[model samples]
Target chain A: MKKQQSRPNILVVNDDGITAPGIKNLIEVVQEIGNVVVVAPDGPQSGMGHAITIGKPLRFDRVDLYPGVEMYKCSGTPVDCVKLAVNKIFKGKKPDLCVSGVNHGLNNSINVIYSGTMSAAVEGAIEGIPSIGFSLDDFSQEADFGHCKKFIKAISLQVLEHGLPPATLLNVNFPKGDNLKGIKICRQANAKWAEEFDERKDPYERPYYWLTGVFQNNDKGEDTDVWALENDFVSVVPVQFDLTAHHAIPVLNTWTFDV
Target chain B: MKKQQSRPNILVVNDDGITAPGIKNLIEVVQEIGNVVVVAPDGPQSGMGHAITIGKPLRFDRVDLYPGVEMYKCSGTPVDCVKLAVNKIFKGKKPDLCVSGVNHGLNNSINVIYSGTMSAAVEGAIEGIPSIGFSLDDFSQEADFGHCKKFIKAISLQVLEHGLPPATLLNVNFPKGDNLKGIKICRQANAKWAEEFDERKDPYERPYYWLTGVFQNNDKGEDTDVWALENDFVSVVPVQFDLTAHHAIPVLNTWTFDV
Candidate 1:
């Protein structure tokens, strides 16, 4: 309820590392509307999903990334960055709004499950903060994020002004073109990646594998995030962390799962 | 539809390394009912969530840990193990059932979101397979699993016989005790980890942090997984990967998201 702070404290995070252009553009946009603090991965953590560092301790350090913008980098996954920001940096005095990514690639549909960028935002939502994750469809190092800045600002302002529903976060994805149609409130498209691993031999002739996949969108629904992006519109999906399929509980009760 | 094969082809995976006692116990129980193929992490990948390795290629090799059990160990996450099992090992033919874990610890409530064990089951569900993840509410290396086998078999048989609801997986958690009550169908409890970082200075005087937390469950709903676990009953929560907050969509549509 108190996410609508005047000169809101915005925690900025991403999966594409601290140095990526995506975070820079996002920081610039968020700074216009709030006091920004950036805590991102020290390296590209794409496809890191909702992973956290448990097997090893983390190295967190403050860095002078952008002039006048307080920033830090962590040697862990994107979700780790959010935890560090909340536990260590912010120290439980949570930011008013938590925004993750203007990621180098799309985090639409099923990609949200495997996106480090989105995972950071999910962690923020779990911390009872109004959170949003932004992503641009382009994946190159020099991917143009110019078209996304205005929309990002608008969405962040709206979220700060009107706090999000409890346990929910916004998943926003923008298409590649400059002449965008508009914004669409959409559901996550029923989609997945068809994986193909390229098997190769190492120097000693031991076999190794490279993970690759083709984006597959079989959902023909017009109200899906994937559909909105294809039509040049920015897509926004309200996502929740409760994984329970509430609908299935009644049917499962009919089963005899015994002692 | 064919998860009820006469001799089910079960794809087994875990976040714990291939040699972990948890998976070994799981494999022993599953062998009586189906042909099992296990693809698990080469090392401990706890808290890895749904991460897939994209930054580097993976090292996958066959291991002879169990006699006549088709087992492979991968230098990747639990999610990656499911992917490799489907694409590389099974060549997309698909397994009859995909079961992940018998994790060394609990993956109930909000822990499901950060659990590598549950993430593997989620991956399997995404691949349109009938999947389930099992966890015992004990974090000890020598945790007793003898009481869990019969219940595990009963649930697996039910799932194979009846099949899970589409795009859903079962997150089954057992309360650690030989005098277990029984199984109860439940929903994910609204909960989170109140994280605290144990900051320490290294030998070189550089600061580091060990991520720690206390599980906080304020949800008083008697129909939640937490309640089921706490009351000495096995918790069987039907989980889904669709992060879309369908209920929030109608309200978000009322927002003025402009061009």
Candidate 2:
């Protein structure tokens, strides 16, 4: 028998469950590049942050969602799906790269803190694997991802060729389908949500609340993810799991304590 | 007439509920330092992970808990408590410092990802204030915060004098009531939870799961928070909210595609 070439195993995951059009599009893109496997949540889990299902036994089903590409539907958080796929499902065989999202909306700025899409990517980084989270600035179910396919292929190939720095992953957000600008490697902008809760009465006259927020970016800097997305560019921000503020350690050491 | 001196205002909050003994002990220690104002969750909201109550109406109660201190119990997450305290409740007056936890257990290593206690402190830092989250390794209602009081007071007074760096907070973890070996200013080690979900049956025979995990430390460096805690010393790690991985930007910039 002739020696066979080894193909890179790519694990595709997303926060918007297994059946979302976002992941379906992502799967099609991955199939053109490498041997792909998808293990994602069964339902939408947006704003889940880096939360893992510790208080629940996760159930996973080997579903035939993406034909030819092995897929599993997991009943857990996005982080859980990544953990199960890496540890239990793959066992000792590590995937060459992990890609999450093509998320329905942008996970830019501080929104990444509460994002299931980004959390799946962050989990991959924590496990020392090269990973990327993709999101569109548009949140519509019918949003066009036609413009993002080429950029996704380029980024995925780069990651596969040159493995990412340990403890780092990419947060790639596409500008709302518009005329081409370009991709900008940027930093997370100084931004936050100005909360507005919508309260309405149910049929039984019981009040319910819906979370709403307006993005507030006071920073006028041009090198931020917010600025890039605003200029119709794909923002590629390298994100890490370590939260340490290395610059503050010296300042903390100077305070006088009675003890 | 002589003007009366206002006591140093200390805002006390935690991931554990307002009624937990941990906060009670925290209030007592803070009372000795200055005036205390507590705004914490009405019930236990551990593992909330910086989640704000954006989709709901918040209600608060001014309760008689700490005799001389003003306290409010809020129907929200820990991050919500900090927000309400800063924007709505305190109005124009900013506190000298915000303190979260004296939490029932450890927030060392990667546990800080899902920590509501640290999230409250991080929120405070975002608001341009010095903040700190203190946790003991013990997870008991009556876990001894006694031995850690001196260290806590020492650190708090230090932060009060020398403010933290912009967008940074301290994650301080004390080993559960043992003879202290002083303090260690350490970096957060690379560690993670080896999660094992325990499946159980409810009285109604429905299966439910509880989150359980064992802390696994792969890093053996002496300069780590894990090493400090293992050596019976209090570990202080300066944590930041900026999730961007700056080092990976150069690598991402090399990626190319036809735009």
Question: Which 10-residue window of candidate 1 chain A scores lowest in summed lDDT?
Answer: A1-10
Residue B245, candidate 2: how far off, in angstroms? 1.7
Residues A28-102 of candidate 1 have per-residue lDDT tens digits of 998998899999999999999999999899999999978999999999999999999999888989999999998
| Model 1 docking category | high
TM-score of chain B of 2: 0.93
TM-score of chain A of each: 0.97, 0.95
Model 1's lDDT to the true fold? 0.94
Give the chain B TM-score achieved by candidate 1: 0.97
- Model 1 Cα lDDT, one tens digit per residue, B64-172: 9999999999999999999999998899899989999899999999999999999999999999999999999888889999999999999999999999889999999
**Backbone clashes, candidate 2:** 5
Clashing residue pairs in candidate 1, if any?
Answer: none
